[model samples]
Target: MRNICAIIVVFFMACSIPGYAQPRHSFALGDSVFLLDNRPFQMICGEMHYARIPREAWRQRMKMAKAMGLNTIGTYVFWNIQEPEKGKFDFSGNNDIAAFVRTAQEESLWVVLRPSPYVCAEWEFGGYPYWLQNENGLVVRSKEQKYLNEYKQYLMALGKQLAPLQVNHGGNILMIQVENEYGSYGDNREYLEINRKIFQKAGFDGLLFTADQANDVARGFLPGSLPALNGIDNPQRIRQLVRRYNNGKGPYYVAEWYPAWFDWWGSPHHVVPPEKYTAQLDSMLSAGISVNMYMFHGGTTRGFMNGANYNDKSPYEPQISSYDYDAPLDEAGNATPKFMAFRSVIQKHLPPGQTLPDVPAAKPAISIDDIQFRETTGIFNILSSPKINQRLLTFEDLHQAYGFVLYRTKLNGGAKGKLAVMGLRDYALVFINGRRAGILDRRLGDSSINVEMPQGSVTLDILVENLGRINFGPYLLNNKKGITQKVLFNNQELENWQMFSLPLDDINAIKRSAAAKKYTEAPVLRRGNFNLVKTGDSYLDMSRWGKGVVWVNGYNLGRYWNVGPQQTIYVPGEWLKPGNNEIVVLELIKPQQAILRGIEKPSLSN
Candidate 1:
């Protein structure tokens, strides 16, 4: 009887159901479908970035993804946030990606990890750490040896945190991407292969793939690896491109299906109507193709980390801090009309025996109508000790990433002629002896201006704003922000300059500056308070204020410009309290007593 009972237990263990069984095999590429335990698998993936959302709110976001009928979640590991300085890395706090992936696993969702060292997600420097600009003669996203060595180190560090989490090791990561969308910038096959070898060397045993736009696949495709397409939901076109470039063997995947678009400063706010995407989604699901929404949810681009972009003949357009991206889930994590429409589409595509969880309850949002400001300060209120240089230096040269840099020098013969600032990163507010002279805006492609000098020696000051660093294309190699080169008066270069570093990546120092001076510079700060019996999410109306940045209870909410599209900065309820909450605004100019109000919905693309 004992022997018979033991035999029964063994039989049950061996005949465990597939649902209860361990993943028989790690995810692998099939000839035309992703194979799981040698059976075909359809990946319904949604993309979200851990850096964009609050650390405390990560698990809730994961639950939302699962509730949306997605079995897979995709995210790009930001190199700048992970390894801000060379050889220095931070995986704690909101930068803790390992914690994020584990949370996804707990939520029963698989992960597609895209660790783009050069992720052009409208992020600063295209996700490259600004310090990379300091590397002597280094060309990023290239086959350059110096760059590859550094890139190799970064990949290894990431692997240590993520490799064990892959499906091969009993974790949930399905595959990891090589570099992000390289073909759009160049046809560097050697560089693409190098990235593959680096990922392999880092112990990534699951799978590796490259993502590129459909037309650029031929240029970006790596031999012997899977190819992923990013763009509109044209399943047929992507299928053909992958079959042609991937040797006719494909599980055709749409890597970045666009449901919404990104925003830029001074550009109209972007919104992609839900109807524009529903039909395409239906067709892809009907065809059984795997799809990953580029921005299933876009949170926010807090801090000075938002990137800027420019063309050969155009001005610099910095990305706004509110990444919102007009995704299904808005910046504040509230579901929109599009979210409801998208839910039905996802529910229709689930496989047999699968069902989506009900949508989570929406977070409450409150409106504060009578907010008031009581204190103010100027940007140049407190100055850092200056570094002397024969000519102006770039931000990277000073080991700084983002913020304002002040360049001051004296002219013995009084400056004259066209005052040209060689390689101005973006914008500059020129002032002479503490008075506004003129403006040099990169958006208008203006770097030099006519200056009429009066008799005696005069002081020349150029407060250059490192609007953002370019994160994509050929220009990415030389994206050293601030004054990249020397400043010139007429045809001659200026000398004996004093440069100050004002990287406002941290607002603590700025808060102290606000205490010293009420108003001193072009950009200024205004302080106020509002009360609430309860706290939730809200949008601070920027319709009345000029262009600048905002902070709530010491948390920087990002930038605000009167320029339409995104006029209100999102304020998370997590940062609020029941009784009193303080609000601070960095008003660049035009300071006055203004009444501020908080609203429930966003006013992007103002």
Candidate 2:
């Protein structure tokens, strides 16, 4: 009897295990039909990058997604921000992947994780660490051994955090994408396979897929696997790509349906009407195709992490700190009319007994004002400057990635005619006797220009601005900050330049000092102060000033440019004071005066 009981127990356990252990749904290929767990399951997702949104607002955003009738949340994990330094990983605070995944789970939402160490979301360096470029002969996003090895390390690290959250692991992560939109770059089958292997090795044995625009699917989509379409607006294109890539499988998905766009320096503020996006959403839903909004919440860029885009010929165009992608959720986390329209459309198509949740209330906005400032250091108080190849270094060297670097050299020949730089990365304003003489822009690629210089023991100041780095394409891989070569006058490279490494990672370092000095070397700190009575979010207009970095109460607002597109700087409300706020301005050029004003809106071209 005991033996009979044991056999019955064994049989019961086997029967229970199959129900729990079966794969969430096999993404199988078939003619005219696609299956999810052998059943048709449509994905309604919303895309929102975690690093861009505030941690405190994650739940609210997820709730917002649910209210929009989204069953899934698609996110890109930025490798550069996650692991700023190689071997040192960070998943805490805003970088927490597990927190984000679990929050979606609590909201009964599935997840699509796009771990593209190369997410070109208008991010700084396209989400790549500048240090990676510091290495000799390091080619990114390819089958290169060195690049793959580093890539593997990051993949394994991310896998450790997310592998357990997959559907098979009792969580809701439904699909994982290979590299993003690779067809735009090349047709390397070997590279795509290697990426698949890495994901499998990292324990991500769940459903794997690839996303690309509709036209690029032929070259971009991997054969015999799930192919998701990105940025597809028309139903015909979506059907064509889905059938073409998935062997006529009918379940199609729009991986990145853009409802809004991003802004750069000198461009007007941007806004997309809700009516257009509503029409697109209605079309996709009515056709029974899954869709994910590119940016459900377009949040702030926060720090110096904003990137640029250049296609080799053009100058580097860096992105603005305000990532507010004209998304349904604005930079301040407020839901716009687009959010309501999307929610209504999705509600109209829901199966029986289902209703979308109510929209969440908007967060309170802080107000700031009444500011005053004072200066403590002048240009002459530097000791020495850093030189490259025995020549005074340009902003490209001394390893200054962003912001301004000051270079001072005593003129032995005295300033006279035709001052020129051998190479100016983007833009530079030259100064003689603490006065502006000329400016050079790389847009023209004309570094050699005439400039007026004064006589005997004169100080030559060249303030260089990081116009921005290319955030997309092959040129993105060639982004180099500061001056590439040396600055020259009439073909003679300037020497003995006093260099200042003004990356400005710290705000407390700025202090009150009343001293007149000169340096023959590198790393100089300039101090200044500004006052404020009330407090609110504002933009500091940095266009009048030459290239350099500005700090309000020690918060790094991001690089500024005299160049068009992004003239004004973003100053967050949290960085302001109720009364007098200290403003320290570091100018790499020779300027006699500094002036600033506050603007309520972002300055970007529409």
Candidate 3:
């Protein structure tokens, strides 16, 4: 065994050279620990998603992680952010993960890539591109041939960009994870095995691993790899769970230790005391077990990127725009009490003579002058040609994701009867003859909404908003938004509906819609301008507004509902230009007396 280790070290030594891809780096799975270059290695890692932060700010965040006494960086590669369209891949700007890894390497930090094609990080559709639904009979997170084919295609394309970055090839990547938390989802050894094969085939070879909660550990791990656990407390229990699957050896690992939790719209802000998880973090280190902070820094979920949730027991619950997670580092990357507490714990656990860097300077944030919308636009006026279908279709069927869809039909006989739509994907406003009759909110879990038919050939319009797609659990596979089935009035199915795809991918349609002469209702796009002699980080207070999306200088900040949990949309200083800037809000409900202001802090629970 010693000779084998020596030979492996010699081989890697021969390969480690400046700028050489896959230079001789040796990282292997020992009885229960990770062996790097024949030595027991400990990983104090921090998890953050590159897609959630701005491209320009990646380095700053990494530096922040380092200052917090972290040796490694962990991140999930979001599939939807890269492959917004089918067969088309993006690897530039904020989606440039290879660049993100290389930048981490510059900071002398190793990386653990959670390349789960199904990463359920409170993201839309668990990071699966919405276009995947367009494939007929395609089942995700399974061994289905078509699904695997697409998965392989995406992995191969991703590999072409990231394969060379493995530590063995001279990069800093320590391990690449398979599908995330599979045990909690199901028992599919075959599926995980396929995942392992494809990852190795794609050149992500260093060490492959699986991570799961305690309840699902039995099936989350595969043979020939390290098994890791995720939880908030009970460090000893975390070690025990990993050992249960790894032959009771040393070098126990916890992949995700939650210091805070995520929040959904309309719910109270989720928070935790600094000692709640930090104490457990200290315990894990003291016990000689390595752990990764699930979210050292939780950033924003800008645009229509936020996901939704629904099940047999619960209504459709959409995540708030901010991915803040109430973590050690706030949404704006400011270190909170949790950050200071963790740093103190880590300081005591550091190897002799190893010192953590000082915390970085905080950016200044301020309130800007209030802005108002002088011009108005109607959604109906500026839309692409409608797709004529006998029945209503899903967003994927219409090649749309993360926006609104309008389904319009005419009541020929001016019928006066009870109207009910079955299985509304999310929220919708029922309209009769251009006036809102009632609203259908999936959050209430009530698929049926009453609608009164008026006299004289009334036109019926149902505008549905795709709050977000579910990111986890049994409902993950079928999270297509918009109307799933048909509408019914008096037990009679309605037909001949013209559906308009309001994807809101770009504001061009909204800009053109400004020509609309008569705009006097909700779902109206209000425009305003604000001037700033100087610019810094700030949050746009949406307290006076109803539920809808917001845009600044044509950039979608994200969805802001009047719900108490999240009342502000984070606007970074870099996104602002000195002088004048534009602000647009799509108030879907009662367009309040538009009183918008910029504040220094987020009123999450207010």
Candidate 4:
């Protein structure tokens, strides 16, 4: 009897060896029969990029997904933020991918990891590190050997942390996407296959899938092996995808179901009605098809990572610092009415006896006002300091990644005809002797403009604003700040440009003093004050101001322009202080003062 008991115990141990003991299940594309664990398991997911949401808030967001009856959480691991420099990887702080996946596991949630080197999520440079732009003759997201090799290295390093978590390895990671929506770019089967090989070599032997809009599935979807998920608003499109990829087999998914949208610098704040979202979500849930909310939580862009878009005709447009996405969860992690409504819909569809945990309390909002600030150093002092390179340097050359770059040059022999910038990325403000003369914007693609030259050691100031990095299309690979080529006067290249790297990563680095007086070509430190007893949410109107950035009580509010669209800047209540808050404005165009007023709602029509 003792020998029989021992045998039984050994058998139980062998059966319970985590994911290893699980049966080898085959997931294949078929007519209405995509299988998970050899069963037709539908994927109900909520999309949230790990890099976009704060690491501390990962669990909360996952909990929100669970509460919405989502069994899967789809996320994109951004390459740029994970590896800012080539060969140098950072998985710590907000860049922690393993921690994020582990948190999802704790919630018993399956994951769809989209580690796109090109995830056009309105992020800075479409999630491609600005350092990649520094590579000579680099053509990103292409068949180029150098680009593919570097991408492979990034994948290899990323796989080290992610491969262990895939479902084949017994973790909750369900499927890994190859590249983002490739159909939108071009039909490059060779490039797609290369990406697939990279993942396979990385030890990710799990199910693979591709996500694209309905029209793009034919071009974007990998043929014959991996199933394709549609990113669409209509439910009927699922049948179309099933016909194309899996001969009528179901378990279809809406990889990116948009519940909200993103806002840009000059455009007014956007808000999607809860009723419309409810209807769309209801249809997907009723159809028994799995869906993922594009962004259940859209966090802040923070620094200079906000990306933009420029059609061949339209002006170069950049996004705002706030990536709120008008999502169910706001930037501060508070649940909106839409969250409550969606939770109700999800509870209706949950399995028997499955109840969502209690909702988390909203973070307290603070109101700060009457803050005071003083500017110390002017543009001239910075220009006089020294030069990093002999020739006029772009933002990329100084190793300064983003934001505005100020280039100054003295008028030689008092000869200045048509001052022209070879390749202005976005916007440029030209000043002569501390006065604004003219402005160049990328919308017009104006290479050179006529400028007047004053006599006797005149100072010339050219302030360049990184409008926004292109987040999609072939243009995505071409991301750099400042002048790409050279500045010229009368067809002659100008030399000796004093470059000031103002990639303002830190707001506390701003110098303030009353005694320091320095000259600048267009030096204007516009100041204002407001009173607040207790800080509440407010939008600071920055519409009247010319091109420049703003700071509230020393916190950089982000770049603003007089251009239409995003005129009012979002000032989070958490960033504010109670009573006597100070505000400072730095306008590149001197002599123009700006007035700021607080509004309850975000400014929509600048």
Per-residue CA lDDT of candidate 1, range 433-475, in tens?
6666677878777889888776687778888887778876778
Estimate, for each residue in 1-606, the C-alpha lDDT of model 2 and write its tens digit: 999999999888865642234345454433443455666677888888788776766877788888778889999888877887767899998889888987887778888899867778888777776667766777887888888888899999999999878876777788888878877777788888888999989988887888887777777787755788887789887888788777677567788899888876656657789998788889888887888888887776766777776664665456677777778866656677887888888888999998877777764443233233344464445323455344655443464556556566777654556776765666666666566566677766667667766556788777666665666787765677666677777767677767666554575753445434343221224454555566666777666765556677766565555544556666666557676676666655424334567776656442
Highest lDDT among the candidates is held by which one?
A: 3
> Can you list the residue pairs that collide in candidate 3?
21-169, 22-168, 22-169, 22-170, 23-169, 23-170, 373-527, 565-604
Cα error of candidate 4 at position 314, Å: 3.0
Candidate 2 to truth, TM: 0.82
Supply the global lDDT for candidate 1: 0.82
lDDT per residue for candidate 4 within 524-556, as digits (tens), equals: 555567777777667766666666667777766
- lDDT of candidate 4 vs native? 0.72
Candidate 3 per-residue lDDT, tens place, 395-451, comes to 888888778999989876555667777878888988777667778888876666556
Which run of 10 residues does model 2 get worst, by summed lDDT? 515-524
Task: List TM-scores for all candidates, in order.
Answer: 0.91, 0.82, 0.94, 0.83
lDDT of 2 at 571: 68
Residue 435, candidate 1: C-alpha displacement in angstroms: 2.1
**How much is 40 displaced in model 4, in angstroms?**
3.7
lDDT winner, 1 or 2: 1
